[model samples]
Target chain A: GAGVSQSPSNKVTEKGKDVELRCDPISGHTALYWYRQSLGQGLEFLIYFQGNSAPDKSGLPSDRFSAERTGGSVSTLTIQRTQQEDSAVYLCASSPESNGFPNRGETQYFGPGTRLLVL
Target chain B: GESVGLHLPTLSVQEGDNSIINCAYSNSASDYFIWYKQESGKGPQFIIDIRSNMDKRQGQRVTVLLNKTVKHLSLQIAATQPGDSAVYFCAERGGLDMRFGAGTRLTVKP
Candidate 1:
């Protein structure tokens, strides 16, 4: 079975340009999460989707950040008017359980991540 | 809000020795704590986890201790090996959010 994966392992763009990062969760995973890892913040959860329900976007830093998951399998995080501060690694994770998760707990398997650099 | 801290803290330990990495969390409502390991240029991989209700939980070679009172978490690795060398992070999860602490870099010397 394949684990989580992210496309465009490395990306570079101008500061004002927009960028999108994609994530493919494990098969049958009902819960998907997006996060940003930076030198100042470590790793911060950006948003998460449970099945077709609304995503939890509380962790998103600002209005410039947004994400959408389609068909409950793929997710894309888009940043509008990227800035140098937005240069960081974007990570994706998924689990079988949405709310309760499990007693033993369903570990959120992570992807290798896509490193974004805004010049 | 996200935490502001170091990119990585270095931890050097001799082989067969035990290593403990500590973390301080800001959110007090958090009930679940987890430890993750990240190799060079790799994403974080789950190592162990401990809930707030339990003060300590042990695995084959690792242990996670949570102190809800002070909002702190720690990961202890027994018989640290060269393979254990990596950056370790402690995360607090609750209310659909998981906040990761600044990672600690562990170097196991044979």
Candidate 2:
């Protein structure tokens, strides 16, 4: 079976440029999540989408960060006006659970991640 | 801001030895905790998880112990091997958010 997949394994962009990272969740996975991992840091939650419900963007670091999942499968994370601080790996994960929230204890399968560097 | 954190930044253990990594979380409302392993140039892979109702859970060669009373969590690896070397992170689920610790680098010397 195909695991979660991300596009453009590596990307380098100017600080003020906008960049988009794509994610393809596993088949039949109802819950998809986006996370960021800075150098020498842990994974930071970014956003989550479950079924048709509204996406959770609480973990997004700033207004420059946003994501959208289309047709309940593919997700795109767009960063406006990239900053050096935004240079990190963007990872996507998906679970089979219908509700992607706490207490459910669902196992999330993660993608290889898209490494972005803001110059 | 509330956050999950680990006590140690790194741990070095000999192969065949038991390795334990500890983490501390501040979100008391969290009911589920998970352990993840991340190898270089890879995304985090789920290792195990434990719910608040249970104090401990075991996997093939891993065990997750959750101590709600102390807001602590630990992952123990039995007979650690070189392949087990990676960065380990502990995460706590709060409401709709899941917070991850800074991560502890584990090195297993063969």
Best by TM-score: 2
lDDT of 2 by residue, B5-109 (tens): 434388999999999999999989998888999998988899999989999999999999988998999999999999999999888888766777878889999
Q: Against the true structure, candidate 1 has what lDDT?
A: 0.83
Docking class of 1: medium
Model 1 ranges with Cα > 4 A deviation: A98-106, B1-3, B26-28
* TM-score per candidate: 0.87, 0.90
Residues B1-110, model 1: lDDT tens digits: 22357546788999999999999888888878889999877888999888788999999899888877877788899999999999898878776566677688899999
TM-score of chain A of 2: 0.91
Model 2 bad stretches (over 4 Å): A99-105, B1-8
TM-score of chain A of 1: 0.89
Clashing pairs in 2: none
Task: Point to the candidate with the largest DockQ.
Answer: 1
lDDT accuracy of residue A105 in candidate 1: 27
